[model samples]
Target: MLAQLRQQAILERVRRTGGVRVAELVRDLGVSDMTIRRDLEALADRGLVEKVHGGATIVGAGSTEEPGFTAKSARQQAEKEAIARHAARLVRPGSSVALSAGTTTWTFAHHLADVPELTVITNSLKVADVFHRAGRPDQTVVLVGGVRTPSDALVGPVAVAAIRSMNVDMLILGVHGMSVKAGFTTPNLLEAETDRELVGAAQRLVVLADHTKWGTIGISTIARLEQADVVVSDTGLSGEARAALSEHVGELVLADPGADEREAPAP
Candidate 1:
């Protein structure tokens, strides 16, 4: 594709999907990674898109504009995978855990599928399905009932009530955004309420977020930074954010995505 055509294609994808990843663009456009990065940079220079760590989000998306799960899954693919692997270490075998709805938590669920005698309670259909497909005879999954959101989160009074009656060793929570001012947040009001219930049900709160979530406030705040027992994110997070998290949260883990790639088995 020509420069103008390729950039226009990239811009359209971002506008339609709320974001577009550089890797996806490179593959689909049949171009080099550098070429796709240049296109994204050009688009960013025009204020057509906001450049994130691994992707570009649509310009002027508000706090209430929740992107769908598929859109979110495409951005920060490696970061989420790295965070998942690192966070999985927190889950002891034969323990109960709660996973809130988000792409990162969904990725984390896959890593936990084989843990013996594990019980998973979740408000995400996607997360539950991960365990269902695994069909681990020794594991149990409790999927809450509620209205489904664009991100596949089951929320409402039903989900909140179900979670309140349960207790888990850990809550692997994911947020739309996090900052000193907003703490952890989500675009959906019901999701925030349901997530708070999940937070209350757990003995420990381990937040899973990527670098791009910083400074991006959402419509509702889930919990304050001090409430988190641990926050697991990727190395792409900024130094200022790291300092803030370390001071407030019990432990701040920065997963190295490069290390994950290096450690992967050869195909």
Candidate 2:
């Protein structure tokens, strides 16, 4: 497994067991003790884990964690950028797309400015601003009016009702967190409702999230895993995560900083 993916697995193991022994990881992952130590050390640097004498334990872990846009934007920058680029490839010119609110989708909005003759609808003020700043006459940008959350998402009955009124070619979404069981989710309940409306309005659902989001469950479920047409995430996702996502999602696209998006072999 890739080093980053290994680290993710280690972190998950630590979260589950509260701590993981180096010997167990070595046996389970079929890696050297030194390699496991290095993975633990790297996770420690990110404050995700705390290294003990022979293992590491989760640090300040909780499922209810929800960071604001600014806080989330600071994380997984390279991963998010690569995911955005790969997601842009899936967009055709002159098609309508809806974007749900979150930092990753906001980053993707920056990429969509160049796609010609597009109609963009979003519940995110930041996303609308990206297109508005471009001031493209050929592209139509619609900002749905509603209550804004700490994540800068406009969510409420107004947003959901407005989203139900239009159909789009694609819906590119960003979530607070996601998991095998919970699927794509948001921390805010109303945002989840609004996102569901957006999902129903699109023919294709493309979710853009980094590796860190894997196995993290939020407050509300937007859709089951099978509902997603595609999931674009970082290569740092563990083998187990990739397998689960492949089994559930229609397409699993892993973004790498240096290469084109990698896809699982189709059955």
Could you tell me the lDDT of residue 26 within candidate 1? 80
lDDT of 1 by residue, 1-267 (tens): 699999999888887777887788888999999998999899999999888767788777688998877568877888999999999999999999999999999999999977899999999999999999999999999999999998899999999889889999999999999998889999999999999999999999999999989898999999999999999999999999999999989999999989956878999
Which candidate comes out best when scored by TM-score? 1
How many collisions per candidate?
A: 0, 0
Best candidate per lDDT, number?
Answer: 1
In angstroms, the error of model 1 at 23 is 9.2
State the weakest 10-residue window (summed lDDT) of model 2: 257-266
C-alpha lDDT values of all predictions: 0.91, 0.85
